[model samples]
Target: MISAPLTRRAIFAQAWPIMLGQTTVPLVGLVDTAVIGRTGDATALAGVALGTVVINMIFWTFGFLRMGMTGMTAQAEGAGDAREVEAMLLRGVVAGVGLGVVLFALQIVLIPLALETMAGGGALDDAARGYVSARFLGAPASLAIFAINGWLFGRGRTRAALALQIVMNLVNIALNLLFVWHFHMGARGVGLGTACAEWISLAVGLAIAGRGVDWGRILSPALFGGGALRRLFAVNADIMIRTIALLSLFLWFTNAGARLGATALAANYVLMQFVSVSAFVLDGFAFTAESRVGQAIGAGSRSAMVRAIRLTGEFSLLAGIGFALLFFVLGPALIAFFASNPAVRAQAGAMLPFAAIIPAIGVPAWLLDGIFIGATRGRALRNAAILATALYIATDLLFRPFGESGIWWAFMASYLYRAVSLGAYLPGLLRTIEVAEPANGP
Candidate 1:
């Protein structure tokens, strides 16, 4: 095992790049929002908003492709298995290409569904259609890029991953200006620009990740064995189910918030901004745990894994505390910024305590998620999510007397359940590692 100091440095080295990458992710969306909003034609802005939402939903669902590949690639790297690494990348590309083809084929149905979801008025329908059509052309590139980035991240090349994203965003921004402003192509232009850049980014990612890969070896029938294919499909399927469950909770929260009076709903919306910000920042540390733990598992180094888990816990605790402090001190101001009416502002401020506690509460679950993902314990993760989700629905129903405060309480319980459930599962995981080590029977 490496010394604590070295492990800490390694964790930071891995974590910081991911933080920067996560930071840039929202910037592209903000730029899209800004550029599209400035067009003066409200219909065009509305169209882009609806169109992007649809795009986001579609892409986010397949995020398992990236996450599922990360653990595999990291393990391959730790095992020093070059052929496995190549196959990991190639497998993702194949999955992504296949999925993208399906997405392209379904656009005829998806585009209209997107419009209906946004409650498309006739005025904005055409504009939304234009944007959706243009973006569909790039679905393949986008999904494929997810796989490539995941491989880069798993291989501990987060800086390279960051560079690819930064370049993609820069290209996206530059083209947004050129096509939307200069050419006045409107919604279609924004979609086209993103598509073009993703295609470019894929080329860049492939060039970076694909270097020295033995495509000849990868093309061999031996490498594309049945076992690898099954593992890949199984891991991804588990993650996809978990993702769906997780997303469903958020949607339920939102839908329930809407059912509450408009003022309370608005307050909850702003309050959620705190959760979103904390999540992005905290994900950096989670990512570090993922890479280090995967490497440790692959190398059969329990000491290294212990060091990683400890360091990650320390970092997560500090971040959770820091988030708690911010939400306590600044929550009112942040809430006030989004809450227009005095009633909404006051109610939101009242809920600051709920919001304030979530970061600290959520630390364990978030940190553990990284460990689970790294270890590829998808069944455990999936089980935890299922239970947590059920607890959330039950809590919400049980606490209806408290109104909006009740909803927030339900969310808190759900987070706590996730942490507790996962923490309970950790011992079994650790025992497995212990049993596997020093016996020399394998």
Candidate 2:
């Protein structure tokens, strides 16, 4: 195995590429919004937003493939157990595939329900429903891709993971242009583009795994036996609850804005893209922390954990500052890109300063989440998130008399609370340490 210092650097190196790969997906969405804006149809924009919300809700549910797998595999790696590492990957894939099938079956029921519930009555509603229905058809592929990504990241193959994501985005973008513009397929075209890209990505991911994955023992039923499946489900349940809370906040935000009116919602939506971009970038550092810190904790190396935490925290802070500055400088141009309507652009522009400040304020919470998760303190992580979210809801209720600005302030406060709560737990965590054996036939 590589030395501690080198392994840490390797983690970051892998993360940077993965970060770029991850960022490209959002960039593609931004481009899609931009292109659709030129068509001068607010319904089209609303369609994309609505469809995205539904898909994201579903996708986030399976985020366990990434979070659960990373923690389990990193620990295995740290324990110096190649067989266990292989088992984790195989179990994750099987579980993800099973979940994907379930999701596909549920989509039939879900699409109509979502349209009625989330999409307001109008042409926009019709467009959103159409888009969602088409996209739902690719549930299996999308979930499969999510599983593949989680396994890859867990194995510390960040570059390969990044490459797969980039390819997916590139394919999606090309298809978006071809179907939406060339064929005049409109919202349905965009959905089709996403579906096609997902399948392609799943195929590529499987091929890549075949090349590098140790296959001799992977096919054994022991890998997916009762004990393994139970552990997988248990971890997944924890993550799913956490993700549901997280996604519910955004959904609530969207729904709340919708109640205020489309213009407000649209403006908020535009601003949210900025938040998404910033969070994804910050997540690169977080993912690095998850892998490195989990490995450190598993290896029973207190020193490695301390160092990993320090490096990740410092780097996240630096990265957050850069994102803050980027938002400050490019605020206008970015807002204008998503919003062509004068009112939407103006309102979003006014909100730019608040949005720009979020990364810096939220970085601590984000980084802490990674640290805690790596340490396998998921219960703490869940509690911290729940507490912060409750704080946010309470603050929002009290501040509702103000305006949108008040809501943004509440959002900022939530991040602050999360950071503080998680930070408070760190001292106790550092006092306890457990290291795994080395990987060479441990």
Locate the minimum summed-lDDT window of 10 residues in model 1.
433-442
Clashing pairs in 2: 80-438, 80-439, 298-436, 299-435, 299-436, 300-434, 300-435, 300-436
lDDT of 1 by residue, 75-101 (tens): 787777877888899889878878888
lDDT of 2 by residue, 79-100 (tens): 7888888777667767777787
Error of 2 at 80 (Å): 1.2
What value does the lDDT take at residue 134 in candidate 1? 92
lDDT of 1 at 431: 66
TM-scores of the candidates are 0.80, 0.93
Q: Please give the distance, in angstroms, between residue 20's alpha carbon in candidate 2 and its true position after superposition.
A: 1.3
